[model samples]
Target: MVQPAPYLLGRFLDPIFAIGVGTLSYIQYERNTHREPGHTLYDLLQKKFFATKEQTQEKK
Candidate 1:
């Protein structure tokens, strides 16, 4: 038998939305980290997102 409970449907979908958003943000962070030309992970992910994001960063 089928039920017509809209509230129950929404409650189940809420966690799915949150998980999807979190996964997307995490993937973006990983991409930015790997594509960055910095020598170390620390330097690449910490800097501003400028045009030189793909260019080599000089040592400070």
Candidate 2:
């Protein structure tokens, strides 16, 4: 007797998708969490991740 089997591609993708979305939401939640210092989130990301600091600085 033979048994039915599942496809390999779907199994691989399921965990990848779950972890990807979970990590993204977790980061977003942490980003909004409380802070001990007086600083906006825009500043924090720049210091930590080296992310973009300024989009458009006004002319002097």
Candidates in order have lDDT scores of: 0.64, 0.65
Cα-based lDDT at residue 42, candidate 2:
53
lDDT string, candidate 2, 34-54, tens digits: 544636555667656763445
The global Cα lDDT (0 to 1) of model 2 is 0.65
Query: How high is each candidate's TM-score?
Result: 0.40, 0.40
- Over 1-33, each residue of candidate 1 has an lDDT whose tens digit, in order, gives 999656633887878978888878876786777
**What TM-score should be assigned to candidate 1?**
0.40
Candidate 1: C-alpha RMSD after superposition = 9.2
Structure candidate 1, residue pairs in collision: none
Q: Provide the lDDT at 8 for model 1.
A: 37
As a TM-score, model 2 comes out at: 0.40
